[model samples]
Target chain A: MQQRGRGRIAYPYIIWMAIFIVVPLILILFYSFTEGDIHNLKDLKFSVSSYKKVLEPIYLKVIGNSFVLAGISTLICLIIGYPVAMIIANTDVKHRNLLLMLFLVPIWMNFLLRTYAWMSLLSPNGLINRLLLWLGLPKIEIMPGKTAVLLGMVYNFLPFMVLPIYTVLSKIDKHVIEAANDLGGNSVITFIRVILPLSVPGIVSGITMVFLPAVSTFVISGLLGGGKTPLIGDLIEQQFLSSRDWHFGSSLSIILMIMILISMAVMSRIDKSPPEEERRKI
Target chain B: MSKNLIELKNLTKRYNDMTAVDSINLTIKENEFVTLLGPSGCGKTTTLRMIGGFEDPDEGEIFFEGKLLNDVPAYKRNINTVFQRYALFTHMNVYENVAFGLRVKKVSNDEIDRRVKRMLKMVDLAGFEKRNVDSLSGGQQQRVAIARALVNEPKVLLLDEPLGALDLKLRKEMQIELLDMQRSVGITFIYVTHDQEEALTMSDTVVVMNKGVIQQIGTPEDIYNEPINRFVADFIGESNIIEGVMLEDYKVSFDGLVLDCVDKGFALNEPVDIVIRPEDIRIVVNPDEGMIKGTVTSVVFKGVHYEMIIESDKREYLVQRTVMFPEGSVVGMNVQPADIQVMKRGDVPCSKEEEEG
Candidate 1:
């Protein structure tokens, strides 16, 4: 009875979720299946035309580009962030917190502000080109393209990758590593045979955290890509706001959600498989 | 006599201002079950780690098989350790954990499989090859850890209190199994533990330590019957340690009574510490029939024996006997000459002072 009474305290939160989250999702589902004025219930008629339009070549390309760019950005973050996390975790306690704080300092600022800061640096007459010219290097052209967009995604999401991996790596028992050394494993071999396998759960969560945000970000593509590269996120935004095509936008949003759910399912499977089974497959 | 497998020449380790292991020399023979036994922070584990090549001694040399091993890394040394917590890799299965060392050396698949299977079988976990390490109980994980280290067949196995986490009954059972395994394997085992009984039960030689220094190194019988100091006597088992004066060879005087003892080599009238084991003190029904008389203060039933505390000359003596002496009853306590152990007074504080401190 006490547990039941305590559970009632969550009723307010449940109602808030129903009104804010569940209602919007249901409206989007309804919009995806109907055509006509959204404000008028009688004018809305059931239709599959928005779903059919999603299958078009142009829209499919936008969806494909979003996934490819997000995948590359997530990979870059893992490559750069993993070593940084390991270094931070291995440092003595006196400096570990300071290093972690430094890594998180940039994240405290607004996300959009950070992306806009990248734009000013990557522009044609930007600080980067000025520094390159001063160093006797040729000016490079990288902005207003997928490369700039990818850079923005990686820069914005690198901390997401590092934090979880650091938490896991730091929690590993020192004795386990010592045991590995006692079992004739050198530093490099011990990392492969023990530490890396143990940190897979962190890697999976890091991938999800970085990839989900990178895939759906419209601000980075807008500011860095200079309206030249349009991803699925930009396409969906244009449909709802500029084109006034809520039906097509809702359909695209549903597809993106399904895609994310599928990727998450795959990531969880990788996390759930025992490290021994993973080795056998290799 | 067997050959000396490992030797420590004044090994010492320090952590900043505090010394963890003081300068101490030791020799461990091949095929010997040696236990570095002591209370926590007594440097037993630190000494074991130095031998395992996990910790480098600040001052002194380690000789393994008569070779200088000062600069040898842990991985390069031909020794393995079963950590106190077992330290089994949680990401791996039982088979993979046992096969870890073999795979590190690039042993053939068939050889690894055969050796891992045999090791698991030896630890009595034959069919648990594919079981996840985290799924096992504490005892099973302990067995897997032992299997993992033993499969490598290192010349020496350093077990850092392998049974410290088990229940009392399981610990007792594992003690017997470990002794049997050591005999069958025929390798030197350097075990570290704070439990004196476990050390006495399993070790061929027990090195009793206190404050980073070895107090005594001897067989269980020798350490019990012939402790060299007050610390060893108080640590190994229940004992009534009292200050006494040596009258001459084969005699000592304590509490205004001269008693016959089997210790000598001390100068006449030298102050010494006398150790009388609780079980060694016999209670006589007739007060005058014994050497000393005291009133029984308390009695406690301890399964196999009755433990009684007797007050004589304002000093309490702990006595263990099969027969119960009721409280407030006057009794005579007698100790044989052989059971009375005497040693020169050392710097270690007495049990009473230690408790007060």
Candidate 2:
């Protein structure tokens, strides 16, 4: 009877999630394969045309460009953030909390507010252009292109990259580092054998953090990419908002979800590829 | 080869406002297993760290085989340390962990393989090469740490409480294994531990320290049987300390009993502290015969011996004898004059006081 009561209490939260989350996901999935247009859904019609139309040459490039931007951003973040996280985690300091807080300062503000600030800085008379002009250098055009899109994405996404790497770095034992040194490893060798392998979990999390958002970022592309190239994110936004074609938008959303799962599957496979020895310690 | 493997001269370390290690001078000879024994915060680890070049002394010179190691970093020094926490690389497999030092020196891959295998075999971890370090038990992990340190073939292996993390049964087992490994390797080892039993069981020489100062340096027998002070005696083992006085050269007086103790060179009637080990005190259980009449207050049987608390002159003294004595047995205890250790208070060295027969 007591077990039944406890089970009843757990039922409501699960029921709430199923009603709110499961119902919408099922509706989206149902519309993804059915015939529809900008005006209204053509009922009693089932066709693969809606799914197939998501693959026009322009939309394909959008998907390709999104992957390039998010992938490059994630790679760069790994190179820059890993070292910074190591320095933060390994440093013996009295004011470590302050240093860490300084690293996380960008996270405290609203995401849209931060993006707006980036726009103000990257404009023609912004801080970067003015600095260049003051140095008697050419006023290079950096905004409203692939460069602006990448910069905006990186700026907004640095914290996600930093936090996971930091968590894994901090958890690694110092004794292991010393043991590496004791085993005849100098700084370079220690970093390779001890530090790098241990921080793999962080690296995986950081990559996922940067990769997922980089691929689906509609805001940075819309505000910075200047609509020169419609990204997969922009296409989905257009289907939902501009085109008012819920069926087509649902189809695009399903494709994005499928791509994410493929990437995640590839990642977990790569993580599992290294047998026990390579992964056991990492 | 130089006679001494490592030497520290006037070594001192300070942390902001606190002095962790005061000026210390000592020579550790080659192939000798020496221990820096002290209680917590007694500069033993600081001393070991300075030796390993993990820490720099504020004012001192360190010599490794007559070479100055003043500006050398830990990597430059041919010394490996087994940290108290067994600092085995959590991310590396057992084989990779052992091969770390060889790989650091950029040894050939074949050589790294052979040497790592040999060292692992020496530590009795042959088939565990592919196992994750964290998956191993504490004792196995400790062996991996030892294997990692020893594979480097450093001139000196410094251990900071290598067995401190193990259970008592495992710790004792490791102590034996460590001593055997040290003998086989035939390298100078600078071991640091507060456990006097571990120190006494392994070291050829014991360096007792207290409050950032070297109190005494001698063999385990000397430090145990003839401690230089109350601190040395108390720190090493269970010892009874009694406040006494020096009546004349070679004579000390305790309570109303003037006893013949073999320590001297103080002025007449100078107050001194006398230390006697528990087992050294012989118990005489005759109804009418013994040195001083004492009633047995309590007896605690410890497998092979009885820890008896005897009360004489309103002062309780603990005595350990192998005989299984019943509770409340009236007995008299006597410690030989040679067993009585006389020491003065304050900062001072051991005096060569002559004893009068």
Candidate 3:
């Protein structure tokens, strides 16, 4: 009886997933294997042309560009986020909560609005250049280029990196750190040996959260890369919206889905270590 | 001349307006196993941290082998601590955790391997090196922590309630193991705990503390028999503490009866506290042979003895005897004059102090 009741309570979520998630994914798979759009499904003919097009040098270059830009943004976020997490985690309770709240306040706004906010700061004659010229410095051009897209991605996804790492760092036992000090490990050695290794799960999750969206994002690249440097996301969008090649777009979407699954598999593999009590029971 | 391994001269520590450790002086000799025994918030841990260089004293100096060491950081100090929760490195296996201190010192691989194996064998964890620390039980983790700290071969070892996490049976076993380890290592061990039995069983000297101050420092026998104040008497073990008037040297009055005791040097008619161990009172069958007559209100059969609460004319007394007595039965209680311990009244008069003895 209890099992049936639980099943009933989960009915809504199950139905929602089947309709909004499973059905669309199946439709995309079917479209990727066929030669035409799905509106006239009965007349569609099966072919492998879409898959072959994905291997062509033009599409491969776009995928490579996407990987490089996303990888750079993820690296920048990790380098900048880890220290911010450590500082917040190490502060006293009263100040730690306040600092974490301040870090999260910017993320409360819409991601699009926040990206536009960065655009205003980075554009040529925008707030940053105006301030620099007023201070007797030459105005520099960074917007409408690869730098702008990388900066926007990092700025938007930074909190995703910081929050997980902070949660892990804060949950670390203070006694463990003290034990390291007691064992004659100085600050640097203690961090490298104890703190960094323990924070691996959080770092892995942060990488997944940042890298996936950075690889498949269209808005940031469209606005900041200024139609010159097209990522895989832009190519898919162009194929589906302008060129009316739904099969090619579906193939790109399938490849993006595979990349996401691979990242998810990596995250789950690192998270597979059972908690201490459960391991003992086993 | 004797060697003093560590000395604290008027050491003090304060947090905000509350003084965690008051101005206190202590001397630890070479290779001595000393324990700080007290209840919670009694500054035992604060004092230990100061000795380990985890905290600095606000007002005086710490000396190591006649050299002042007030400014040295914890990593530079020649001491290691086994924390209360064991603090075993969860990311490392037992072998790696025990080898951490040696690796930090840049020891060679052969030497590290030899020392790690020897220490593990000393802790009776010889074949468990490859096991993850998290998979081990609480007692095993504690042993690994000991091996980790001892491998460094520090001049002193500090343990802060290291047995607080184990079961009762495991705690008892660990207590004996820890004492043996201390003796074999021949290093000064400064252990902190609130368990009087643990302190009495292991230490060469017990420093009793209360309310951020040192109450008394002596051997186990001295602490049990000659508690300088009422707090020491009540905190250390079970005691029937009662109020009394010191009539003169070697004479005291309580419960409308005067008794002769071994204490002296108090003013005539000075109000004082007296402690009598429960086991010291003898239960007699005949009222004529006993000093006080009472009826047994409650009786509980403990493992080795029967603890009975007797209500006399003046007050109630907790008496422990080997034989059982039925509840609501009339009984006679007798006490010897030598068993009556006299002490000075410490702090203010509280209700807990004025209860039945």
lDDT of each: 0.92, 0.83, 0.89
Q: Ranking under lDDT, best-scoring first?
A: 1, 3, 2
Off by over 4 Å in 2: A1-12, A37-44, A130-136, A273-282, B347-357
For all candidates, state DockQ relative to the true structure.
Answer: 0.59, 0.53, 0.49
Q: How accurate locally is residue A8 in candidate 1, as Cα lDDT from 0 to 100?
A: 100
How well does candidate 1 reproduce the true complex, by DockQ?
0.59
By TM-score, rank the candidates, best first. Answer: 1, 3, 2
lDDT of 2 at A15: 96
Model 3 local distance difference test score: 0.89
> How many steric clashes does model 1 contain?
0
lDDT of 3 by residue, B288-351 (tens): 7788889999999899999999999889899899998899888788778888899988783222
Highest TM-score model number: 1
Error (Å) of candidate 1 at residue B243 is 1.0
For residues B1-357, what per-residue lDDT tens digits would candidate 1 score against the true structure? 999999999999999999999999999999999999887778989999998888999999999999999899999999999999999998888899899999999999999989999999999999998888889999999999999999999999999999989999999999999999999999999999888889899999999888889899999999999999999998888899999999999999999999999888999899999999999999998999989999999999999999999998659999999989999999898999999999889998534222210
Which 10 consecutive positions of candidate 2 chain B have the poorest summed lDDT? B348-357
lDDT of 2 at A127: 88
> What's the TM-score of each model vs. the native?
0.96, 0.93, 0.94
**Candidate 2 residue lDDT tens string, B1-357:** 539888899999999999999999899998899999987778999999888877889998999889899888788778998889888776568887787777678899889888999998999999999898889999999999899888889889999988888899999999999999989999988999888889999999999988789999999999998888877877878888888888987788887778888788888899888888889888877845666678888989898899988888758888898886677778877878898888885444332221110
What fraction of native interface contacts is shared by candidate 3?
A: 0.72
Sort the candidates on DockQ, descending order.
1, 2, 3
